[model samples]
Target: MKVLSGIHEPTKGTITINNINYNKLDHKLAAQLGIGIIYQELSVIDELTVLENLYIGRHLTKKICGVNIIDWREMRVRAAMMLLRVGLKVDLDEKVANLSISHKQMLEIAKTLMLDAKVIIMDEPTSSLTNKEVDYLLSSISDHESVA
Candidate 1:
């Protein structure tokens, strides 16, 4: 399969999300348009916890007010919900490296979910998963419409 995205300047094609053209959108706006990607091999930080991995690029701490802290409580709650939605029972605070292959993939899915992404691009999502794991992953994906 082939996928074309990003800005294609001096090119005939255009990519759009929610009616906004990629060429007209800036990097930050494009990011907010919600494009989640998951590679065959997990690209997560081994040392970070599941919750931390989910918030790797975007920090929840930045949303806090003066007296309000990162609201880790909220992040944890959302992470737990995402894990459950993805059909995994993992410790939100557990390190990514300590997880099994299936668990890691599940974590990655949950991480993407936390981003509230509208489009998800997955490459070889089932490459390293067991039969059962693949089933779960497929089922999870069927619940959403992605650009994969």
Candidate 2:
């Protein structure tokens, strides 16, 4: 999965996506190519608000007085939509540390969706989820697959 996500390079074989062969790749390129990964370990920042976490490295920005500033309104709107898609309903300003484990997992899925990822590789996504959460997560994935 690390190799596929461009965290590590393959020693031999090449990776082909959308008919393009990549001999070398990096995390940024992989994300731009719609490849997203959710590791077994939760990656969401506990101190950050839901909206902040959603747009951490890729915040929407607008030029104001010749300076770039985060477009908070746009980020909130998009983050809400992404959260809805993953069946996660929470305040955008709420901190992640206040969320449940299942909610955090759902937040991870929402993050990937916000990236417009076409292919999501989840590593033991259900490991920490309860039976009901697992069912919900599976249903969400199936729905996303059909739509994509």
The candidate maximizing TM-score is 2
TM-score of each: 0.76, 0.86
Candidate 1 residue 73 C-alpha distance from true site, Å: 1.3
In terms of lDDT, model 1 sits at 0.71
User: Which pairs clash in model 1?
Assistant: none
How would you encode candidate 1's per-residue C-alpha lDDT over 34-91 as one tens digit per residue?
Answer: 7776767787788999889988766665444555457687778877878877778878
Residues 15-120 of candidate 2: C-alpha lDDT, one tens digit per residue: 9988999997899899888888888889999999988889888889999999999898888888887787777879999999999988898898788777767788
What shift in Å separates residue 85 of candidate 1 from its native position after superposition? 1.3
Query: In model 2, what is the error at residue 64, expressed in angstroms?
Result: 5.0
lDDT of 2 at 34: 81
